[model samples]
Target: MKKIFLLAALIGFSPIFSQERDQIRERDEISPDNSWLKVGITGGVPVGDANNASSFALGADIRGQYLFNPNIAIGIASGYTNYFGKDGFDDFGVIPAAGFFRYYFTPSGLFLGTDIGYGFVTNVENNDGGLYVNPQIGYHNRDWNIYAYYQNTFLETDMDIQNVGVGVTYNIRFN
Candidate 1:
């Protein structure tokens, strides 16, 4: 009876022991290789000192990013932002080319990022390019991103132009 019981238990447990171990998966399942391009549109209000110069802002941008891991991404971005003058001021635009870093919170789809680079002034005479910084927070999924940001440009003329804005992006995955 003891020998029969031992044989029965071993037979019952054999399948469990023979199965392969589970493999670890990447945090973001959307991209196995982790590279993508994002194209988007932005709209917002000119704020603080910028409000006196312009009332509304509108723009479009494109970004290329590589995910170093599940939580971190480094990228380059370029965009055009047009500020509509309030009344007497002439309408102007800025073409911003920036390098950025982003940190994502897993499962929550939330991210924080910052862009630092140059803002080349356009459409208005006598104004020159300047350094700019944009800090942002957003929520993203496999194919979409929605974010809000504050962009500040420190111009050569001692004027600081800033905007409070929201943007939405569609992501295209590569591998």
Candidate 2:
């Protein structure tokens, strides 16, 4: 009777230990990766010293970033801005090109970004370029994005320009 009971217990537990589905999941269960080009439309008013000589501004930016990991990305960013004329200065344009990075903090696409490089200021007659820095925060998604950012340009002989703005971006994939 003891030998029969031992054999019954072994047979009952053998299938449970040998099951493959309990140790592994299906391969196609994860979400697709996000890495692509970004085109944005932005508009906002100049702030601080920039507002002293210029009116509101409108701008656009382009970026190509690679999602190196799920939460981080690095790439190139460039922008074009036009500030309205005011009493102290004529209308001017701003162009900045920089190496940028974005860091996502949540699973739902909240992120912070920063960029540093050179910026160009122009009124078609006299042009000057200098150091640039940009910082941003918003919700970044694979399909769409919305952000608020600040632009700071350090000029060689003129006062630094500071503009604050909000933007919307769309993500596109070729394949």
The lDDT, on a scale of 0 to 1, for candidate 1 is 0.86
Runs with alpha carbons beyond 4 Å of true place in candidate 1 = 1-32
Q: How many backbone clashes does candidate 1 have?
A: 0
Whose TM-score is greatest here?
Answer: 1
Q: Residues 1-175, candidate 1, lDDT per residue (tens digit)?
A: 9999999999998776655222223434436357899899999899887899898999997898888777898989989999999779988888888999999898349999998999999865778789989999999887888999999888888688899999998888776
Model 2 reaches what TM-score against the true structure? 0.76
Q: Clash totals for all models, in order?
A: 0, 0
lDDT of 2 by residue, 30-143 (tens): 223545778888888898777987889888888877776678878798879888879968888789889999898865679999888888887834438789898999997668
- Model 2 is weakest, by summed lDDT over 10 consecutive residues, at 23-32
The TM-score, computed over Cα atoms with residue i paired to residue i, of candidate 1 is: 0.79
**Candidate 1 least-lDDT 10 residues:** 20-29
For candidate 2, the C-alpha RMSD (Å) to the true structure equals: 8.9
